[model samples]
Target: MPVFLTIETTCDETAAALVTDQLEVLASVVASQDKLHQQYGGVVPEIASRAHVERILPVIHETVQRAGISLADIDAVAVAYTPGLAGSLLVGVTAAKTLALALGKPLIGINHLQAHIYACRMAAGRDVFPCVGLVISGGHTCLYRCRDPLDFELLGTTIDDAAGEAFDKVAVMLGLPYPGGPSIQKAAEKGDPHKYAFPRALLDDPNTLDFSFSGLKTAVRYAITGPGRHDPSQVKLSDQEVADLAASFQEAVVDCLVGKSFRALEITGFHRLCVGGGVAANKRLRTRLEEEAARRNVDLVIAPLKLCTDNAVMGAIAVEKWKAGVFDDLYLDAEPGVVRRSSALIHG
Candidate 1:
């Protein structure tokens, strides 16, 4: 099987990976920017770009060495070219293009969202067709009707803040910590999700599969403070209060995902479900979704917690493009405001 050297610098992480056509990861390395972005409360594009420039080369070197191959053995250079910050995207694109040219190999540009779906398949070692892929991360919360590995149609998406973003914002409002998902999940382990009845937005939209987490996030904020969306200083949360809020917020997000995902399965007659993105790492979600899938006799494949977030091994998503002869040229440039535009909306 042909092997590709892949790179992903769409956001705060700088990653380089080597994957075979069989989806066997030879070596994958990620230089995370979590610490740098922690103080800022979120990913800052300028900082992300500079960090990528600094980390890309070293990460690539390490991955290739770990893979036990030199640039000469790689068949192509693959990179995420869409749906990412321009500065960060540029770093990956330029590096990929340069490698492709220097190595005299084909250049492949990939869609970041599509890669997330493909990741489920790679981790599961089976087709994720006829399923729904719920991508919940700081940057995105989209429901896709994945007809095939490469062919997907967007069924719904976030109209405002994403689920992961909601967690981050709520974390800040609660004075919890940065990178809200983990912190919230950790605290949620001790809280009661049913203790609070937070709202789930756009649950009844007649013609849209769109989601809105801004309201839920606001709800979390208001619960802790007297008034205002985010007045953490107004009220003090005992240890119990923090856990309860985290649990409640996590439950709200999970319920919304479960409702929407099951509907996608029922409507499309696709019993298999694929969950990806950072928030997919939530322990509650993994258990609940699996239970739901089992109850309905449907197959639900959730990636390992490690694969749930943005990492390089998942970059093997390019294997399909490589096999399909879908290659790019050296003229590729990066776009900071890359949005993973929906493929299409499918009813059935």
Candidate 2:
């Protein structure tokens, strides 16, 4: 089997993995910048990019060492090139291009969002196509009608803030820790999800599949500090108040995600649903999805918790392209922003 080295520096995580032609992961390593950006309440693009530059090489070396193989054994190189922080993507793409040039091997460019959905296939240990793929993360919240591992048509997307981004901002409002998903989930466990009736924007609009979390985020803000110009830092919230707010806010986000996911399935008539990304690790969201899927008789595949966060293991999607003989030239560049497909292209 040909060995491939895959790099994933799309955001705050510096990651690399060694995989075989058969999708077997020999080794995977990720260097997280959570602590570095924790104080800022969210990721700072410049800081994330700089950290990736510093850690990408070491991460690749560690992955290779763990795999018990040297660079000579690798047959190809792959790196995520699109839908990411510009500087972060450039670091990985530059490194992969350099390695491919030096080793005389083909280079493959992976789409970061597509790779997230592919994580479900990795977890299933089987092909999971012709499904509705929902990717919820700090930077993305969109749905795709996935015809195969490589073919994805955009179904719907967020009009404002992504779900995970809202979580981070709300966490800051409630004095919770950064990387808000996990922190908010933990805090929400002890509170009533119905304590406050947070708005679920666009949920009532069955005609469209778009999501809107900005209003919900603002509602949480007003709940914390009345709809006035008061600093959130000065507002003292008791432990119970924080927990209740977290619970209510989380419920609102989950409602929007679940409602939209099922709507996509209904629209596409796909029996299977695959979900991945960082916020997919939320316990409440996972349980709710499981319940809903079971009730609707939908085949649901969620990436394992370990695979839910940004990591190179999911970049194994590159293997599919490699097998199809799809390769990228050295001119491959990073696309910092997401490019959405027109609604007219959506398949029923």
Candidate 3:
């Protein structure tokens, strides 16, 4: 089996993995910078890049060791080089390029967002193509028509803040932790999702698949701050109030996500839906999607919790390209913007 080394530093996680041509992950190692970025309430690019610089080599070393493979055994080097923070991406790209040059191996460039959807395929251990793919994370909330491992056509995208970003911002208002998905999920456990009828933005239009979370986020801000210059430190609420708000917000976000996803399936005439990205790890989102998928008779495949968030295991998506004999030049660069293409659908 042809084995490849994959590196992923698209964000705060310095991760590396070893995988075979058969999509079997032999070893995966990640060094999270959660503690470093926790105090900032969000990721600081400079800090993330610095952390990646410090941890990338060690992470790769551990992955190789765990895989029980020597440097000479790696057939190629794969790295997520697109759709991420430029600095963070540079660290991984540079490392991969150096390894490819030093070890005389091929370099494969992976799209971070595409890799997220590919996680579903890795977990399913089968072909999940020609399905609707949903990627929801702090930086991305978009739907795609994934025809193959490398072929993705954009169906819709968020016009404002991503769902995970809304969670983090609302968490900040509620004095929760930096990575708000889990925090809000924990707080919402005891609260009522129906306490407040939070707006499900852009759900009224059947023709549009795009998402809008900015208005909902604004509603939450006004509810807590009441149209004034707000100080997160000064905002105070009872534990119950906090929980209720969290529940309500989370419900709204989930409604938008699941609703739009099923709508995409209906429009595309696809029965299979694959979901990935960090927010895919949310317990509530997972449960709600599972229920909806069952009711609507749509097959749902979500990335495993460990693979939901950014990691090098997904970077093994490069294996697909490797099989296709796709390789990147040393001059490949990182793309910080969301990757998208014109809609493939045609209308009268």
Candidate 4:
């Protein structure tokens, strides 16, 4: 079986993986930059790219070593090059291109969002195309109609801040830690989801699929500080107050995500739904999705907690392109922003 080397550095996580053509993950390694970014309350692009440069080689070396294989064993080199920070994407793309050229191997460029959806295919151990894919993360909150492993139609995307970005911002407002998804989830456990009644933007608009989390995030800020209040430093919140705010903010985000996702299903008529990304790992969101999927009788495939976050293993989606004989030249460059199709909102 042919083996592939996959690199992922779309964001703060630096990861590499070795996988067989049959989708068996022989070895996977990831180096996280959470501590580096934690103090900033969010990712600093320069810090992230620097970390990737420093960690990518070691990660790939460790993955190859763990797989008991030499660089010569790799038939192809795949790296996610689009829809991420420019510097971070360049680090991975440059490394992959160099390795591919050095090994005389084919270079495959992976779409970070599509790879997130492919994490479901990896988990299922079979084909999972022709489904609705929802990617919820710090950088993205969008829905796609997956026509195949590589073909995706953008159904809807965030008009402003993403769901996970809102989480991180809200966490900061509440004086919680960075990488807000987990921290907020922990604080929310003791609070009530219905306590504050945060706004669920665009939820009532049955005609449009685009999401707007900016308003919701602003609502959280206003709740913490009065309507005209700008600084949260003036307001001292108790443990219970903080927890309640966290729970309420999280609930609003989840409701918007779930509502829009199911709406995409209704519009696209896709029976199976695959969700992946950092926010997908939230316990409350997972439970809500599971319960709703059961009630709606929709097949829901969520990337396991281990796979939910950014990782090179998901880059195995390159296998599909490989079989199709699709490959990129060494001239491939990093695309920092999401290149969306001309089609905008999916109107019902």
Candidate 5:
């Protein structure tokens, strides 16, 4: 069994893992800088990049050690290369390339979004193709039709604000801590979702799979800053106001994602729905997805919490590619944008 060493630095977390072709996760490690970025209320590209540089080597070393494997035992190095901050992606890509070249192993480039989708396989332990994938996070909000592990079709994506981005913005408006999704989710548990009714975007049209959350973000801004506007510093949102706003905001995002995902399942006639990315870890979102998916004929697969963010174990996704002899040279470059690829829809 070939072991693939994977590195993921597509965002604030620098991670590495070792996995076998059978998808057994030997060891996975993540070094998170959430606390470091919290003071800024969001991730600073420079700070994230520097954090990756410092964390990448030690994390990979420990991952291999924990797995009781040597670097020479791995067959390939897979790294998430696209659809993330350029600086952050570079740190992982550069590290992976360095290790691959030094160790004489083949290097594979994995898509960040694809890694997020395939993270389900780690927990599900089986092929979940012909499934609808909804990836919602601070960086992305997209839906795809998956026929297999590697094959994916882009049905729709966010036009402006991603679901997670809206969460952070709304959280800032409500004076929540940084990395707002979790903070908001926690606060909302004590609040009522219907206390403030927020707009639901793109629910009317079946043909339109695209999403827009900027207006809802704007609505929150106006609600806090007051219409016809006062300085943001002029008014402080009460704690109740913040909680209600958070509940309403979280509800709006979850409703849009869950609704559109099922609609896509209906359109594609897929029997399974898979969700991942940072936002998928939300308890409310997961509950709604499970309940809704059960109501339909579709099966629901949610990635484990640790793997939901940019964790390297998702690179177990590279096993099929390794078996198929897919590898790259050390001269690989990071592609930091939503990629359109044909081979993405095939899973197993």
Candidate 6:
């Protein structure tokens, strides 16, 4: 029962967690920078990185305290160092490396994307590999063939904006709050999903698993504030109008996500499907997935709502690497772009 302390600062959240090799989350803490970035309606990298610098240590300390564990009880220090903001990723990687060195523990660099999928394993309390893993978030919309804990084969990725990004942009258009996912979900609850038939990108292509939300986003923009459309700010829109737009947009995104995910399962021939990331927390998306999975008789695991968003608890995926002796040296550096494997490390 080796316990690992994990840190995550991939984007706007500074998080830390304590978890056992068995995938039990002893404690988890996340410091959100949503208020800091809310005014901007999106994440500002420099602001996010600085916020992480200010909050990372405090988060880790709180997590350890909540877990009721001393530093000596930790077996390894893990951090998600890839596929994230360069400056933010650096904050977590540097913290983990220092802790591992100071405590004489093994250092494990976790892939943020893979850990998102691993959140399924953590929640399921069992193995969930050899499945189609769909990661839908603000920055990434991709599917992978997860053959094992550490082995993932790239299946399809977004050619344009991710599903979550579209939600944010559309939320801004509707004059909603910065985190469009929740705001839109709330609005859609009162609106009509069929008010507008938004485009479902790549839905017609059965062979392709990649997603395209940019077109959908653009369509929403034109529908609301295009040439002939009244300016959103100048025109007083009825509550029903706002709700309708939100509902329609959400329905379109959910349709695409559910449809493609099932298609991925079909192509992979895997009865189990795992979905992760912030967008996966959407209630509509969850309902549609559940309905479809039931109809198809496929075992599905949506990362628990809390784990659906970025958090260090998912970093417990590092335990798999710890057991396999897959350790990273102190020289490991943060990788901002998408990377398939750990060999994409740069010495610090």
TM-score of each: 0.95, 0.98, 0.97, 0.98, 0.95, 0.95
Candidate 1 residue-wise lDDT, 149-227, digit = tens = 6777778888889888888898887677789999999999999999989998877555667788888877877788745
Pairs that collide, model 6: none
- Residues 298-325, candidate 4, lDDT per residue (tens digit)? 9999999999999999999999999999
User: What would the per-residue lDDT of candidate 2 be over residues 1-348, giving only the tens digit for each residue?
Assistant: 998899999999999999998889999999999999999999999999999988988999999999999998999999999898999999999999999999999999999999999999989999999899999999889999898988898888898999999999999999999989999999999999999999999998877788899999999888888998577878999999999999999999999999999989998989999999999999999999999999999999999999999999899998999888899999998888865876553444
Write out the backbone clash pairs for model 1: 83-338, 85-336, 86-335, 86-336
**lDDT value for model 6:** 0.89
Minimal lDDT window, size 10, model 2: 339-348
- List the global CA lDDT of all models: 0.84, 0.93, 0.90, 0.93, 0.85, 0.89
lDDT of 6 by residue, 236-257 (tens): 5688989999999999999988
Query: How far out, in Å, is residue 56 in model 2?
Result: 1.0
Poorly placed runs, candidate 4 (over 4 Å): 342-348
Pairs in steric clash, model 4 = none
lDDT tens digits by residue: candidate 5, 68-152: 9899899889998888999999999999999889998899999888788899977897888878888888889988887787777
Q: Candidates 3 and 5: which is better by TM-score? A: 3
Off by over 4 Å in 3: 343-348
What is the clash tally of candidate 2? Answer: 0
Model 3, residue 235: displacement in angstroms? 2.5
Q: How close is candidate 4 to the true structure, as a TM-score?
A: 0.98
Q: List the residue pairs that clash in candidate 2.
A: none
> Which candidate, 2 or 6, would have the higher lDDT against the true structure?
2
Angstrom error of the Cα, residue 159, model 2: value is 0.9
Model 3 per-residue lDDT tens digits across residues 1-348: 889999999988999999999888999998988899889888899999999999999999999899988989999999999888999999999999999999999999999999999999999988998899999999889898888888887888898898888898889889999899999999999999999888998876787788999999888888787886667558789999999999999999999999999988888888999999999999999999999999988889999999998999998789889888899999988878765658464111
TM-score of candidate 5 relative to the true fold = 0.95
